[model samples]
Target: MRLTYQTDYALRTLLYLSCLPEGKLANIQEIATVYAISQNHLMKIVHKLGKLEYIETIRGHKGGLRLKKKPEEINIGALVRMTEEDFYIVECFHQQTNRCLLSPVCQLRGVFQEAMAAFFRVLDNYTLADLIQDREMYEQLFEQKLIEIS
Candidate 1:
């Protein structure tokens, strides 16, 4: 199952913080500029992340954001589950699926469930630390540092 844009951004933001030396601030605007995303949207994501205690925010001069916990402590599966609201693989898999006549007998539900389990299994193998290990390659792929406040 493909991730939503919001999950993608959240992961990217986490990965950015994960790569940092630790206890360093990463400005929201810098992340937005680096990712070519809207600052407004990034702010919302940051607020949610901070609320979850994944990251900490600081205001005023010489202030920005940083991770509250280490990268290894952040479970990818948990992260996705927290950030993603829908895990449906198909239209028939959605909550309001009265349209599917054979849903009761259809093996699609089991298949989808297996598919989702496998997906989480893969994600579970990698922590945010593992994701940002190849820092230069990651920076190159994203065309910017994960966190750049200064």
Candidate 2:
């Protein structure tokens, strides 16, 4: 199953923050501009990330966002679970609204469950730090130092 734009943005946001030199701060507009994403949408993501304690935020003049935890500390699987609203891969996966006739004898449910587990297993293998191991390449492409957190 494909991840929603929200999850993608959250990851992007984390990546952007992680790539910056330690203790650097980036404002919403700067990050949105860098990724060519909507500031409004990024604002929601930033807000949730703050509440989740994944990032720290400060308001007013000279205030911005920074990572609260190291990139390696951020678990991709856990992030997906937190950001993904639903894991119902199919109609049968949900008991309250499932109407599939094969619900009584479907092997697809087990398969989907296994597949999802595998998906998380793979994601758990990496972190934001792992994603930016090629930091020089990323920095060259982005054409800036971006942000840093201490």
Candidate 3:
């Protein structure tokens, strides 16, 4: 199943933060600029992330955002689950909205369910830290963007 833009942005935001040096913070504008995303949209994702405790937002002029937990502690599967609104890959998957008369006998639904389970099973094995294993690479990429923006 494809993820929504919100989930995509949240993952990107986390990745950007993960690339920062310890104790350093990043602003929403900077992240938006770096990723070429809408600042307004990123703000909403940031708010949700903060509420979810994935990132911490500090107030004041000098304040910024940073990860509240270690990268290794942030499970990718868990984060996806939190950020995603629903897992209804198929119409029949959503009971309330489903209109398929074949749902009861549909083996396709079971296959999709198993596929989704396997997908999550793989994501469950990874953490934010795993995604940033090439920390230096990501750091250089982000730094390059900052340099260009400057």
The deviation in Å at residue 109 for candidate 2 is: 0.7
lDDT of 3 at 147: 98
> Model 1: how far is 79 from its true place, Å?
0.2
Give lDDT tens digits, candidate 1, residues 1-150: 788877888998988776655456778887787788999999899998998899999889999889988888898998999998888777777867657878878888888899889989998887888777788776565444433423
Give one digit per residue, the lDDT tens place, for model 2 in 1-150: 988888999998998888777667888988888788899999999999998899999778888999999989999999999998999979998899999999998898999999999999999998888889998787665555334310
Question: What's the C-alpha lDDT at position 128 in model 3?
Answer: 98
Off by over 4 Å in 2: 144-150
Off by over 4 Å in 3: none
> Model 1 shows how many backbone clashes?
0
Ranking by lDDT: 3, 2, 1
Best by TM-score: 3
* Reference-based lDDT, each prediction: 0.81, 0.87, 0.96
Count of clashes, each model: 0, 5, 0
| For model 2, the run of ten residues with the poorest summed lDDT | 141-150
TM-score for candidate 1, residues paired by index: 0.85
- By lDDT, the best candidate is 3
How accurate locally is residue 34 in candidate 3, as Cα lDDT from 0 to 100? Answer: 98
Better model by lDDT: candidate 2 vs candidate 3:
3
Q: State, as a TM-score between 0 and 1, how close model 3 is to the true structure.
A: 0.97
Q: Which residue pairs collide, candidate 1?
A: none
Q: Which wins on TM-score, candidate 2 or candidate 3? A: 3
